[model samples]
Target: MASSSDPKLPPLMKAQFLEAFNKPYVLRSVPLPTVTDPHDMLIKVDAASYCHTDAVLAAGQMRPNPPSFPHIGCHEFAGTVVALPEISTSPFQVGDRVGVPGRAFHPCGTCFECASSPTAEDADADPPGYSVYCPRSQNNGIDAPGGFREYAAVDSRQVAPIPENLSAVDTAVLMCAGVTVYAALKRCRLKPGQRVGIMGCGGGLGHLGLQFAVQMGLEVWGVDNADAPLRLAGEVASGARVIDARNVDATEVVARLGREDGKQDRGDMGLDAVIILPESQDAFDYGVSLLRNHGKCIVVSFPERGFHVSARDVVFRDISIIGSLVGSNKLLRETLQFAAQNNVRAVIRTFPLSRLNDLVAEYHKGRGGKLVIDMALSDGS
Candidate 1:
């Protein structure tokens, strides 16, 4: 508990706790987290966005290494720094606004991966976008107390300062969904004017991916089954070609969009890359089918069941299928900066923390846009 000297700090805080697997979350009062490690900071969370990963975790889907019981289960969040270690190397100060991604794994700085990767300008951190892959990474809300509570203790290396223009809600979404799509797009390495299709474009990550693809100068196609998602994608992304995956044959569409003879002269014919953002196996197959020879397909979603890919397609088409996790701290920072600069914002609906169960139910049903929990609100509100 923070001392009385800090009026804003509360001795006890409310948090949603998971007692065990396949159990409902228990919301109750708990002691606020304190800064123990030299590089740790105590953050007063402003907003925490719900993700499908959290839902999956709640269902006991991530077996073998699921979060230990009695844990908080949100990864994407943003807040203000309330306390910092007395002797710390972090540039952030108390009261600094910051956003945290799901897994902010700190690089050991001496590991093979870190040593081999390009060094940051500061020389202390790993190269941008590599820290998330560090072997000794710590995931918030899973490996430790998360932002579902009012105060969270986070490693400074995993926290990025939020731009002044972005609201807390938008920053929260960007922490997970934004950096994810941004990292996936970076993996594609598409040249300007290349065509890119985003599967599940109407959902949270999908919509953000579409905007990122557009901002990166790619001719974008938004693929989804729901009309609302398609309409929202068009509204926010602008100029994106919306396709109803339920009605259209994705393979045929790709064939018509790409050059049949392998001639490169056709303008934007055939997708240079397709980013599969949905959990549907059919969507994954369709994404692979839509790519031109030598094109790339980036898989960003995780379905409960494993999906099979044809080995023959990879061997013959020379198409690359890459799996992308959440972006590194460097990429997260870049995503925030890019979104702020480009006026790319997440469309979100805010709910009070008290309604967490209701929100989770809604999320399970699947909805358009992102769902964010506002910690400032009370249960009655």
Candidate 2:
């Protein structure tokens, strides 16, 4: 990986960005991050996805800037481990292809959460929400550079091996969206043959949820307002009952597709749960309305602050609504395996890494599906 100028080390990698906290990202020559720790490996990024959270970070909502001067934009990506400065450990090797989840960089082997419970946490334990933490909340972004760059240094523990058959673009989207929907589905306690409805079924998260639900043996009902998304939902999750949210009342639509008689006992045939993946308040409200007597409404989207839900209806129906963050390593690993085996992939548009500026602008134009950055485009493309 050495360039012509330096024989011992590679030329400084370039990162693209403008001034922090309100400027567009631009690529400039920068050093390729090194593996200073024995447990770290240097990976050449193959692909990365542009997430809504990336937009938030770019817009100055999360952290104004990473600890470093220039910032790279990418959190979810799949790449090959190009260098391992220490002994080979865990499941990864020198050239193993792996996908990086957002939380991978946060875990310190000595963390209280990881030390206390590897499998399950105490119900009362108040664990640090993010694995990557700082004494000041703002110091948190320094651990791992985002996935948009040509190379990234990541902890071996956070890496998940991807199947050779799966493309990096597919793995990149699954790192976040797939893990999110998987976490939400677990909260629903999906049972074999149970019915679950997913709102916003054609977007990044919703589409994956539909496939996961179908593979788990649940009857999936996908709800979306637009015809194109609904059509995509049908194509991705065959046999799923795709409903047009605008054409009919969701409650009525769910009722019609429910049981044989369109009615069931208090426990028999209403929706077991609803997974709301869209940021719309309407989706949240509709999710509650379409629930069965004791159904759970799981909120996976981060809506703007000051949003409200109806307290009275929730109390009367015994329906529980809970919010979920991305997921833990355990759940993320399971999601990767499931996605690898079941062929779940993000529908994506690829752009060369150098064209990131154009890509970001197009992303704002409401591109359908996920947008992936092809880091390998510098050489391979």
Candidate 3:
């Protein structure tokens, strides 16, 4: 914890990152983020999450603006606000525990898109339709130093105050992965008694999606490759169903869901929507096959390889494919509330921020649930 009066704090803070793609994230010293504007605040990072996107950044692909040699990248983190601007309308006060979604530090609210349903619409809208095709993407990792450090600077609009009682590790994933899924589900226009299928439900974001879908009055069917992730997904989303992605036939599984299954008593075409979060193109292909007519597939992953869909299949099925980003500040707040209310959270393996490089390698193994970097560790653990 840091005090607002600590003007003598270190000029630089410890961070971890790879100098380039296909390298390791190692500890290095970087300038502590400073608050230069009234809407800006400095946070003492308590915990942060490592998503698949972080892995891609480490691997040197899909980074919008690759940081120069020795970059720090971590987009999702929970912390305490230690500094505040002189004049602000944000509900947050200094000392408030909060989470910063490692996108941009702040958003420009004056953009035409941001003005209309700012929380639901893209803020990068320019010239209407022209901007729709190429939404203005904010630069966080490339343009600004991201989390993965002891402290971060965030714009008030990009910050969400988290419940003090929630575990920082669990809430950390919510900052990015959790909020992304929640936002995608909202876009699905889900209804009570609707059947929802989540591909890659064992994943960090997928697992949270399953939990959210179940709590939101949908019957969830989680599909994943591993037995452990499948079992864990079921545990996280009580009464939600699971399918073995590697072995199960997509059409057969959809058929089973349509018919009453003894285990969950779910029947088929019963599905109203589906969300896909996978790094592989095959998952996208399979997700389309499982949807019922008029079902929506909300995609929230950036695959290393591009996805190719058959025009005939899409046209005939009346299925819709949509993409979503991390989420708006309003959605982030809703994520916190949903998690607090339903006890939905990430199953995290904690590591001291000091051991970030080594942990990045470990996370690459893909055996853990979620890995959280605890920046507040004593002596860097």
- Better candidate number, 2 or 3, judged by TM-score: 3
lDDT of 1 by residue, 1-381 (tens): 332225577779889998887777889998877675677788889999988778778888875468887899889999998887666667888879999887754546566665565544333234643466556766787666677888888878778899999989999999888898888888787788888889989899988988888888888988888877877887887868888888888766765665454554433346888998888888888877777778888998878776788887689777788888877677889999999998888788888887888888877766678999987777776
Decide which is better by lDDT, 1 or 2: 1
Candidate 3 residue lDDT tens string, 12-85:
78887667778667777877775766767778888988888878776667655555767778888888887765
| TM-score of candidate 2 to 2 decimals | 0.86
Which residue runs of candidate 1 sit more than 4 Å off their true CA positions? 1-8, 105-107, 119-125, 128-130, 258-269
* Global Cα RMSD, each model: 3.4, 4.0, 4.4
Q: What tens digits encode model 2's per-residue C-alpha lDDT throughout 136-227?
A: 22211232467777777777766678877788888888888888888888878868888898989987788888888888889888888876
**Residue 243 Cα positional deviation in candidate 1, in Å, after optimal superposition:** 0.6
Q: Is candidate 1 or candidate 3 better by lDDT?
A: 1
Candidate 3 residue runs with Cα over 4 Å from true position: 1-8, 85-90, 117-139, 261-270, 378-381
> TM-score for all predictions?
0.91, 0.86, 0.87
Q: Deviation in angstroms for 270 in model 2?
A: 3.2
